[model samples]
Target: MAHKFPRISFFQRWSILFKCIFHYGMIFWYG
Candidate 1:
């Protein structure tokens, strides 16, 4: 259980970064 926690947190951080980058890319492309 302890080992699983860091993996989940890492995925969450990666997903957040991906989303933020994608969001800004879209705005920069279309805005």
Candidate 2:
């Protein structure tokens, strides 16, 4: 359980990071 927590948080952070990068790229390209 404890070990899984780190993996889950890592994935969550990665997903948020990807989302931010994707949004920033879109705005830079289209806005």
Q: Specify the highest-TM-score model's number.
A: 1
What overall lDDT goes with each candidate model?
A: 0.94, 0.94
Worst window of 10 by summed lDDT in candidate 2: 1-10
lDDT per residue as tens, model 2, 1-31: 7676998989989999999999999999999
- TM agreement with the true structure for every prediction: 0.81, 0.79
Q: Number of clashing residue pairs in every model?
A: 0, 0
Residue 28 of model 2 has an lDDT of 98
Clashing pairs in 1: none
lDDT per residue, candidate 1, 1-31, as tens digits?
Answer: 7576998988989999999999999999999
Model 1, position 20, has a per-residue lDDT of 100
Off by over 4 Å in 2: 1-4
Candidate 1 Cα errors over 4 Å, as ranges: 1-4
